[model samples]
Target: MRSDTCQHTAIIGAGIAGLACARALDAAGLPATLFDKARGAGGRMSSRRLPDAVLDLGAQFFSVRNATFRRAVEGWHKAGSIAPWPASLWSAQAGRWQRHEDDLERLCGTPSMSAVTRHLAKGLTVKAQTRIERLVGSAGQWQLVDEHGEHHGPFTRVVISAPSPQAHALVAPHDATLAEACEAVIQRPCWAAWALFDAPLPALPGVDDDWQAVRVNDPRLRFVVRNQLKPGRQDQGESLSLLANLEWSEVRLEDSPETIVEALLDAFQQALPDGSRLPEPSALGAHRWRYAQPDVFAGGEAVNLDYRLSASGLSLCGDGWRGPRVEDAWLSGHHLGEALAADAI
Candidate 1:
């Protein structure tokens, strides 16, 4: 039941977007506090560590397209928090493999996907494992209530960087405009499976052993990446991240993790070339992201606006407000933080 009566900005969610917003505010000489239900930051960028494998169950790699994000990426690269990955790519369709090149520079967090968010979260005040279930007060003075019924607030403003559906629930009772905006965005689900093999996978015909990733046009699996091949990762074993197709995952959303792990592993085997056999995995696991990516913008065409700000000191920012890329999430929060610093919200 601890409470704070200070004049601070309360940011709900310590993901990439939320961290970006907090950083922007900090640079502008404003104080903000971040809260997250997870044990650490990174949100979708989080990673899982096993006895011999470090698997990235979400956001395998991110590309830099915009100048702002590019600049940030450069800094991260210099700071050793991120590194380029997947220099070789392959595409698989009906068990046919071919070299795929897109000329896009993709980077992943060093050691694990969560490193980037951890770097962003450094020096910032964060309350981890705190699920803010309710916004209790009104207007200028707001209070946040967690799932344990613990109250923590009296903040000047609140910014929600969670997924669209979760954000909608919090804003519905306060601001209709923000609520409707959140409601208009739909998020898709994804089931990611990780497997650590005792040995390397067999190379496909005409494919080199250095091939690190694959884009599969299969009904069950969509993308697969070799964790050990990625830059800055220790070669504990042949680790693979199997990402299931969106529609396939959505239909089996409630399925148990064991079911998902088995299904995705079977899918990966089917995706291999005709005579190639997959080695027995030493360890396996699965993670379900109920709200993984933005599916559609029900409010007509997708808007280019990076964020949404309300006059009631409530603001919204995330990939749902912009696009699905990690860059979009960062931009959304960064722009909103700037606006708030200028007293625009």
Candidate 2:
């Protein structure tokens, strides 16, 4: 629970977790200041506009499982901002590709994946395009230090929602105990390629008519997505997105985008059925996620919050602790928010 003396809060990382935490604080009559290095909110839950189509180059889609996230999804659905994605999932194993038929309640933002997070960010005090390099405490309140060495702060509490490695860097200078927790967490990288073709692709077996996205066991490419197939996506010439396998992406992290795009497109071609033919793409590009996902660990135990430092007004939460999905991020932030609310924050 948050103390009444705890007034304004500073939240780093404008992704789902930070938004959820800010909303919770605001609900309890506490103000919040959100900070991120990006030009906009929704870290990896972002979308880019191409000449012909909108591409969700980050999070392809999300699924609702636990009640907490399901409740939020219902609100987004009623707001007409989200819908179930009807695309199929394919996984490759031992050279045999099998379709995933679990009938999952997959969800995605209507116009773009960031739409959901953008909706949650309304009415909050957000400092976009500003990166808070570190946190400092003075007198009693907490202060934020930007990369430019400027100071901004005097907040009651601080919540960090960045990736574990980034989070560790921020807190290690202040609290070594908490730094160890953040350092113990590791992450994986991913490389994504977006391409626009001249025409629509033929519908494949075991998938819907709108589009096709598959997970393959290729050397470079992992998942291939037809952007237009999902609900609320742009309808035009084919806009396909390819996600490289994690190991491959890590190995090629330093490669140029043009080089990566060519490799991925070639991998996609090789993944197609024998003798399948398609025209060359009109445009092609790539993006790299250096810390894309948390590396799954063997031990089940991990730190969630360092309340021992809470007396000094600091807390840490992020998807890097549990998972690297939308729901995981939301729940972690949501739980902290509820805790603060219970304390009458």
Candidate 3:
């Protein structure tokens, strides 16, 4: 139940950013309801469950850079919501594989990337499969109209945590400055393919069987993750999540999934060294993220403000406003929520 004294906030999108914002607001005793078009939360952090394997088709893994996010990650790790991933990492450079040596620690949600967002979403009111088409009513009393012609709210404020393009569409009518800011940001598309193999990947001479991920510097393939090797997923069969390069994905954005799956699989095979072979895929799937990540920040550079909060009770925050990393999305929304809560006080 919501506190009657607190102003109600309607948050659109249930990805990491939205959930992070909601968490902050909830901690401050603010009333906020999340709305997402997907069947459940997690947005890019969501996962797909196969018959015997789980694949992360969106963000494969994230690294914590900010101290605030590092603390949150620590809490999640203690709660068993996330764990370090890619026990081994490699990079395919000049047609040869080399160890990716880095001191940075990367984390992925336990079981799947969605677990983190799902954990954040607990106890928070969320309306799934509710795609808010436009904002209705006036400032100080905003209403959300969904695709089903359903009107929700009389919300005191509406915060759009969608990608910059989508957020622009929602706030254009209410606040020109917010819309312009959203418009200034640029995003890119991506193609992710999942392949479940009948057998584990063939081990290389120098690479260990535990080699979990590789950065393929091929023209077509950017990343290939051994999904089954991730923590909390050892029970599953061998599976791989193949992410295509941004340029390749953008060129073939409208291509069919079947075409993409085949292309990425071919690219993966080609990226392998001599005598290396892959097991036959038992199942294959592909997904296209129209706004996968922001390519350029607003005004061609990162700004001082982490988010945009208008006097009209309209606001915007997402990966575009910050950097493309997962930490940026969370911080953008977290700071926005903190600002809103402070205003109410």
Best by lDDT: 3
- Each prediction's number of clashing residue pairs: 0, 0, 0
In model 1, which runs have C-alpha deviations exceeding 4 angstroms? 1-7, 298-303
Overlapping backbone residue pairs in candidate 1 total: 0
Global Cα lDDT for candidate 1: 0.87
| Cα lDDT tens digits for candidate 1, 144-205 | 99999998888889999999899988989999999989878989999999988887788677
| Candidate 3 regions with alpha-carbon error over 4 angstroms | 1-4, 299-302
lDDT for residue 311 in candidate 3, whole number 0-100 = 92
CA RMSD (A), model 1: 3.4
The TM-score, computed over Cα atoms with residue i paired to residue i, of candidate 3 is: 0.97
Query: Where does candidate 2 clash, by residue pair?
Result: none
lDDT of 3 by residue, 1-345 (tens): 433465999999999999999999999999899999999999999999877888999999999878999998998998899998877999986458888988898999989999999899999999999999999887779999999999998999899999999998898887899988988898999999988888778878677778899999889999999888898998998889999999999999999999999999999888787788888898898999999999986521255787888999998888888889889899989999999888887
TM per prediction: 0.95, 0.90, 0.97
Best by TM-score: 3
How displaced is residue 68 in candidate 1, in Å? 1.0
